[model samples]
Target: MNPDQFQKNSMYIETPEDGGKNFDDDGRAKRTGTWVTASAHIITAVIGSGVLSLAWAIAQMGWVAGPAVLFAFSFITYFTSTLLADCYRSPDPVHGKRNYTYSDVVRSVLGGRRFQLCGLAQYINLVGVTIGYTITASISMVAVKRSNCFHKHGHHDKCYTSNNPFMILFACIQIVLSQIPNFHKLSWLSIVAAIMSFAYSSIGLGLSIAKVAGGSGEHVRTTLTGVEVGVDVTGSEKVWRTFQAIGDIAFAYAFSNVLIEIQDTLKSGPPENKVMKRASLIGILTTTLFYVLCGLLGYAAFGNDAPGNFLTGFGFYEPFWLIDFANVCIAVHLVGAYQVFCQPIFGFVENWSKERWSNSQFVSGEHAVNLPLCGTYHVNFFRVVWRTTYVIITALIAMMFPFFNDFLGLIGSLSFWPLTVYFPIEMYIKQSKMQRFSFTWTWLKILSWACLIVSIISAAGSIQGLALDLKRYQPFKPQQ
Candidate 1:
């Protein structure tokens, strides 16, 4: 079924017209401009705050290697998107729902719960990744402000003036603003976010290119030799290989769940009405080029010791106006992207409530042990409590794991294997009703095996990275 029809059919009793299709709402299905759906996904996924560190990661692969990885990622991303579109075109007929849930998709493939196990694995993986992203973004913002904007040196007079306050404040703001749940309301924000993201990316690229053209070799040496640089991988070929692994990383960037949510955004029109293919292609190509530029520019600018937080490290000389512009862009960008990740969790909770409980029981609090409330029936009370608690939990998780860029890459490495690599092929086999594996299927099996192996290696590397970060950890410390 098309997106507009899905929205109309899939809504709940309370918010029937809202069409909680995992993504945004579609108020102007046939009448709205083409930019509505096309720009939303790009703004939400491609313009994430993670791009701030693209340069540093790319630099580890060297000047030439970094952009090459971006290109590879773009190609892989394009191919994967097509695969997803294909899957959508020929959905399993048995599953009446137009969209595929992780568990449902698995059930379609592996007969019973084997695929469900995979979906369960994905649940934990996505939760961790989402939490990690929130935390990492918080931390990066902190580092960016702390790098210079705060007190120049130790001063007794500086009270609530640290980066921590700003982080908390901004995160809280995001949580509150993100709570507003209407896609039609958010589309304008997405458009604005896209504009800001493109602008930030453009300026970031220009700066990188300008630095490259300045012809200062010694500065490169400084970047290479800097002891505290986050991207230091000068002599380590293994690290370079890790950098070369951006192809798979780029595929991870596709972030399928986000698309699943916004499925309703894709409206149908008359046969004469052209598909929004142009808008979609534009968004993809723009995002791909931006990644390429950022990767290349970052490596050239920072070399070995480049900061993991690219927005802060090389942004020392960013024009004031541009900085202000990027801040607004990033703020909206965060809102757009944050909703994509959060919507599934919300849907999960919402669906569970609907299936497992009657409206009267929920209103009357049939199970009060886990529930809390302030009024008669108190269902809404506990629902508020539930959402509030999640917000707090997500915030705390963010606080605990603040290494934004590194943690994101680690999550991508560890989880990408199972979720994107293994699950899709498995589902295609069982759900698509192909009795035997074809040549393409054989290649997919090989790819899955490779991904499985890489998942292992990357997990080890990630753990090591974590261990290094926690070197000072101890159950107890001797009294000073």
Candidate 2:
């Protein structure tokens, strides 16, 4: 309860042989001490790309809502994360030794068969995020090229790829290069990437703010539209109502999976808990500060009617130099995306194979070989096939579904439902007998149900939006 007691409790120890396969000359010792650094890398990877979208999400919610939602979201995320970490301590651990994923928590709670169904839902959402981001980055790439500011400055072919061939080639290269075995070893690359993204974003935002400050003395009014109606539109109430929505924008920035990357890093248990907890706290706090500053500054600079792409919105009003900086920032941010999205596929493959072959027996490189990491002929001929497939699929979806705000909301409702809400509570209650569940446990149950219901509603909304788009693309079709 006290600080000293908390510290002691947090410093729980985990043995080397405790939670996994021993695959080196030194039985429990790690061959490469990359995970500590990788922890920071994973933080950058998880938090980097999607953050630029937060202000837009908040603006949609209403200006007043931004900071409130951001704070509330962070609080919920922090609480949920602590609960999840505790769940791992359950006496009857279901996912012992194996690195349990988000779906694994669902399986342990709801049982394996149910996990498959939940996994399907989760996959749909993950696929949406994957596709949406890929398309966003691709379009961003083209936009960077067309923007007069970046164009006038210099001409790097890699920096300006609008055609399909170059898009696929460039994206694939980034994805593959990111997957090199101990890519986590290159963790500092992520911190550098984050710093670059932050710097670039700051410069563009500052420029936009200066522009707005100099020439926006005149006031104007606009009619409220469908969603805009949610904000109090009365002349006196509108300003405060809009201000409240900033929290949701901030909330949109809290993604939690970065901590999972350290399954190998932290020794599993009570002893190493302090270091792990400290790391998570630091990562979350740093991320929250970054989001709040960027979101507030962005909305202040661009105003509520800003477009889906923050950089694009800034570019429209920014000086040429600032626009060029924005382009470079966006490009660097995409590299972070490559690291986050691509790593899972690579890890999945490596784990699949590592069980059968000794570390030395496993083959590597561009060539395909007979290993568990390699799938049967259909899916495993070349790693390029999978990477290319994801890029193409993502591109098509992005072009078709350009309502990125709605897409991200759906992603949050679906993926975060099982991942951050339901699974943590369920795993703690169901798996760990040592973990006590009080009558207030009903609160978590209620939260889980709310998350599930919200996800279903959001999914329906996505379907409705897609249907409407289809009608627009083919207006002559019979009314269904």
Candidate 3:
């Protein structure tokens, strides 16, 4: 239990002598953070609009299987996150290179070649996440607007598209918000996001239960992907739905991209890992409960016909005030969540631009460079232009691929294996130096391989389904 007693083989706090690349000039990993703050960060990162898909996700896997998969993913992600934290410190903690980003961690453990892949995966995940957020925000706006209109003009009398204007408005908000400096400045935003997450999540649970108990909503059994339960027993449709369900679970728990970033935000010290592990435990446990309750209650409330977005299943008039509030909360939360996920991307792009164009006339980006690493900061033209473009592009992608649940599955299947599963498992095995065929080592290897297999299958299923949906739904050119 002693904090001084080294844990995770190599994970430790850095000292001045280490002279590692990841630290600041002041030799501090982070100026202000605690386990509570880290928990909030993880909550905001892991539990986003993905929660909206839970009922539909469960609809694919069935009552018992869905919740079980959710539980399993939570446990697995938590454990792998711990493995990742352990790699934060090398055997000689202070002398080891500080891993501030997940890419940094991969590079430190696997070398430069693999680091590029990690960097790609990490950035792709972040962009995918930002696009996901934009889609969710637009959808939330559309839902709220429709709900209001329905209340005013009777149900089914009016309908509204998740139009281009709304999507652009959401992106404009992101374009402004995404420029909010760095993680240090986002504590308040993250806290709000975390609170908003819980607010909507709990409200969702309550509404689901009330709806079910009050005998409202479509309550027929269905296959995992919302097909009528008894109608289709054997087909690729069923198989694809099951994989999509798995991918949804992965997406919900996928925070490995920012795991080290969150950890680095903690105060630098030997007990950093202990605190991080605790923070991880807190985050995992909290999200696990939310996912289970929300998903289960959502499915129970609207069995066969649950909307991919659970709240969309609710008729506009039934719970006007609460639904509007929840949607607003969800939208606002995503505005910050978009920035949180985009941080890594910003840093990556900014650093690249600074280096690639360090001599270019237009790239006079000195505001962030000259300032002392602290709270308030200013950004230059290069920073503004690149980041704005990035946000715009991602928002456009969201509009193009607006199928929320399927997009979540594709992103999850695409990035989770590389960022969360393969790297963490490989890094853990290397750091632990466990015997190759020993029981623990063998099982871990098997688990790692299983994740790869799962990702491959999930990718095939998701891509096929997404391709079909994109063709059929044609959410193209942004509906106006």
Candidate 4:
């Protein structure tokens, strides 16, 4: 019947009073996460490879508009994230039932009819995210390898350019990392991933500032060609550019797909609203600062000449070590980010399997594996096979669809509105039992409706842009 109220055993009924702890003493959570750990995962979820595109985004929007959009979205993201966090609560922890997955939250609030819609959106988001990450890792490895070759050869000689091999190699790394068992177990890896994100991002930002100061930027760049500061563009071009910039920031800031599950990893706490609100503030504020630096400096460094990805704009042996380090960090961060986003995907898949095969490796506390005294969660068969294969499939897509921007455009276009804008607003209103057509409800509805319409328009443009680019670039052809 009600999945949130699904009884794991006869004695365990989750309610608002019990704080969602089904067992009296969960050794798993005891050893798991603090608010710091939760913040680390949120950082991993919030700041990914997308920040690398901010300069290119700012280039499209101009200094004023770009940073304004980023700041606005950051505030909106924090607000919506808190709304999602509120949904994680119940009347009592054990008696009322808390939502662990976005789908579960939707199913509980809206009904089973709307649950699958949430599932479709989430599944697409994760699969697209995994593909996007694989592509990024492959490209980052290629960049790292090229920098190494430049250092060795003392010139800009072309090195190994095919990304498929690197994609496969990176898939091996994901294979190992994705098996960390469950969400809370990933807290450590998420911390490392967040560190690596700052590592590469800071390097990129520092490099951009240096280039801009050094006056190394060419007058004419690929994305910024024929464009100047202060929005001196035509009507159609402005609309197109604004939508493009919106897609970039929206996609870059997107963490809604993983927000609920990330909260699930929090140490059973004094209501997740406070903890998650704190974590969201930390993660989004830090990420916004980084985005502003990267976007603004990147535009300054190579005004009208900035590349779509900031790290790739450096040519030849110039600043070889720093560029190489940035690429390495990109690869490292992607490995962890992949698993962070994929956890809910894995959970969604395995839940069905666990239900179907109750006699198999479906683990409970009593039947848990004897892995360690410290941990309550078990290592099981389904975890090993399914997760490994999922990474492998994503790797294949990376190889096949090698265009980085196109896949990202598609992801941003498709999932941004549903995941980021619409669902949270609707869910909050319904869950809070707010009055219809009241001032707050009316304003939120308008905002969400505006978001949906813009998202649809942007998605259409992105699809067309991606299709035309694929037709023109045909990246799948073996690289020279």
Candidate 5:
């Protein structure tokens, strides 16, 4: 198509007056992102605290089911994510009106109550993830301290530490980092977080490899079908744990909730969907490789007795400095991962408030503030208060519960089907004008329904695990 015709069809015109320098075709600031930045964001969001739990997750299902589930989730997530990337534009993948957020995409394609449902599910999942990150980061912080304590004292010494203080410290740090304007400004942070993820993941993988090669001088039994039903767990306990293990793998592969938002940051030319698809491929393959190695190797090292979080679960007490460094990497990675997830919530609320009360200065106004060494910054009062409050509330919730594995499983189960599978399938069908009950449509529906079943069972298991934990533990108390 010619430039004029393309502009008319897509509603993207670059006028001679401004020379297309400052603003994009959508009247927003020019998006400078390439697939590299998008991949970094994906990596930062995908490889998080969930990776630490994979060894335990694998142990729950044994050898055969664990690796199969990991590959299955990786395939499902990548396929659906590409579907979501296509939805970044509307009727046409390259030229239709832009849907800046996940809700926006839903509203454009599916519309009606589905949009509201999508928003509810997406935002709730996002909030839960931030809370989970808070809990995980605090655990890492506590692990660092306890690791050092174990080194100073004897390995047998009981080095108890409170997670509440570390939770507060993490919240304070988030309050400051939360001020970052939007997703577009987070590329640098995502790069750093992605590196941290690799660092800690590699360390964990290496430690596991060392343990396997060097031998722990103890028999570590592993089975093709996983933990023994009679010896390691009861029949009922095995059922629940298998479900929760699936949920943990689901959590490990989840980035679909923010996939569209990440796509929005990409510059046009090769087309956003095309760029996002490539990024998704790179990001998912990279994470899946790490997930497979970590989960398998850690399982190999610890067998059926694997701890929930190998790094922080006292799986490796010696080489104290290396363990401490890995935990620190985890904490730092979570710091950036928290922002990557929560920034969407921040943007949604701020945009809604501004539109609802357009004339209110407290809601919509921006003020200029000069800072030393950082130059001038634009401050919005409403954003400051709301974002800070959100961080504080999540931290408080983290302190109250702080069941890391259970929380991860629950959040994953709640979000995986709706945000990751169902919506994308529905949107793709609508956008492509697929015939009802067609062969392809039938298979897609089958996939969607299968995932929904997985979500339901996974959720039940997580809730059951949480209930058991709650019965035995007190709220606001240090876990270890």
Candidate 6:
């Protein structure tokens, strides 16, 4: 089913008389997305603020394990994503009924209590991601101000800025863009965001390369096994950081939760699963190359003292204008990503509300609003109010606890095993009717169990990190 079909139910707008030419078999507008657009959405969702933390993750895991883990997670995510892509259609891979959302896929394939669990995990992760994006965007906004301040005043001078105002600004931008109906209309935004992501990531990578080449990194400390147990951290700290680092990488590779939704946007001429598989390969390979470059180069430049965020972490103080531009790119990229992640939640809620209150005009109505130069926009009062309120609440929560790295680790670890690994694996097994003790099934189960362990330890480390940060943190206070 087309997810947007739910939104179109209450609209008073006239339908096109182009017969069935302009609509899909599901009776919604025909999808125009190809592998390229799908790749753009994947890249936008995948290479987010999580990329900035790769240096820190590498530092914690060392040269050997760092790149190895990065590659490992990339392979795992890509492999499972392909599996999930096949689950986009039910009973048959290509010529079957459509499943609109990730939850819908689970309901169609894995039914019963697992579906409920999958929905809970998926939506909770989505909400957490939006909150995390709010915090990251504000941090980048603050970084731009700090970059300018350092350029004018000096590096040693205090350049502290309050994140609350910037977060409010971000929330305002999101509140406006969140009205763009559904995922079907976000292709342009995703493309722009994909460009911005590459912009900042390239800047970070270039800066790291320059630092390594300029001999400023001669005194930088690095090790094969990551942070020193005695000098850099205690043994327990090392253990916790390694787990946290794993979680960070997991977060970096996390786009599987939305893979089905993205595939749902594709035109079905050559088959969506085939196109999505190609898109996933392209997107994941492209991102994996960048991840290796940025993570390794950043670590090579700053070594063990690498900051959690590459662009905003004050690693390079002299290139102030470049830093400002990169931060601006981050802020802009996140503006689009915020919608990509949150739109699913918005769709789910609005769709559910329409069903429950089918007769209420307030819930089921879409009024035609004529705009200047932009043409007519169908406005749903419920959507505007709900989406705006949702953004405000996320912004407030971001203001309350704005720890970036730890929060990301927590979110990634919490969502990775279930959404990225277990659900896809289970759905594939069931849909393919694989024998329980078959080699492929057994190995898949082993992989799932292994990732579950990773998730547990990663979550523990993130919670510990958050706990440590909270002990020294004051709520609503400006961070430096």
Model 4, span 1-480: residue lDDT tens: 124323343235344355635432332223245678778777766777888777877877776777888898888788888877877755333334666667767777776656777778878887898898888888888887777777788665646467888888988988877776655565777678888988888888888878877775456342433255354556665566567667777788777877887787776556567788898888888778878888888888866555667787773457788798888888988887787678767775766666767677343212355556666645676777888999889888777677665567668767877887778887888878899999999999998888777677767656655665566664433221
Tell me the spans in candidate 4 whose CA falls farther than 4 Å from its real position. Answer: 1-41, 91-97, 154-160, 175-187, 217-242, 261-275, 357-389, 474-480
Predicted structure 6: lDDT: 0.86
Cα lDDT of candidate 3 equals 0.76
As a whole number from 0 to 100, the lDDT of residue 350 in candidate 6 is: 87
Better of 4 and 5 by lDDT: 5
Candidate 1 residue 152 Cα shift, in angstroms, is: 7.7
Give candidate 5's TM-score. Answer: 0.88
Candidate 5 stretches with Cα past 4 Å from truth are: 1-41, 179-186, 261-279, 313-316, 357-384, 474-480
User: Across residues 1-480, which tens digit of lDDT does each residue of candidate 2 receive?
Assistant: 011232343334455554546542223454242435534744564465456666555554545656666766666666676666554323434234332344444554556666666556554545656655555565455555455634565435323334344346456656556435557677676666778766766665576567567756644222222125444334423333233233223225435544443533555433333455565566566677777776665666555564556666655333655676666666666666555555555455444444444343323333444558656322233344445566566655555555444455556655666666666667666754433455657777787786566456545554554555566643221111
Q: Compared with the true structure, what per-residue lDDT tens digits does model 1 show for residues 230-289? A: 443335434533632442244336454443333324554421012333444566687776
Instruction: Give a tens-digit lDDT track for model 5, residues 283-338.
Output: 99998998999999999998998888877654237888888888899888889888
Alpha carbon lDDT of each predicted model: 0.52, 0.52, 0.76, 0.73, 0.86, 0.86
lDDT of 6 by residue, 1-480 (tens): 223454365333346699878888777788999999999778767887898999999999899999999999999999999999989999888998888778779988988899889878978888999999998998888888877877888879776678888999999998988888866565787788879988999899999998889976459899998889898999999999899898889888876867887998999899999999999999999889989999999998888988878776652287788888898998999998888778878888887898889999998998999999989999999998999999999999888778888888999999999999999999999999999899999999999999999999999999998888778886544443
User: Model 4, 288: alpha-carbon shift in Å?
Assistant: 1.2
Ten residues in sequence with the least summed lDDT for candidate 6: 1-10
Better-scoring candidate (TM-score), 1 or 6: 6
lDDT of 3 by residue, 373-446 (tens): 65556777777788899988987787677877878888888887887878888888877777889998889888
**Per the 3 Å backbone cut-off, how many clashing residue pairs does candidate 4 have?**
19
Q: What stretches of model 1 exceed 4 Å from their correct place?
A: 1-44, 89-111, 114-122, 147-163, 178-185, 215-218, 222-252, 260-285, 318-321, 354-379, 430-437, 472-480
TM-score of each: 0.72, 0.68, 0.85, 0.80, 0.88, 0.88
On TM-score, the stronger of 4 and 6 is 6
Cα deviation of 192, candidate 3, in Å? 1.9
Report how far residue 2 has shifted in candidate 6, in Å: 9.7
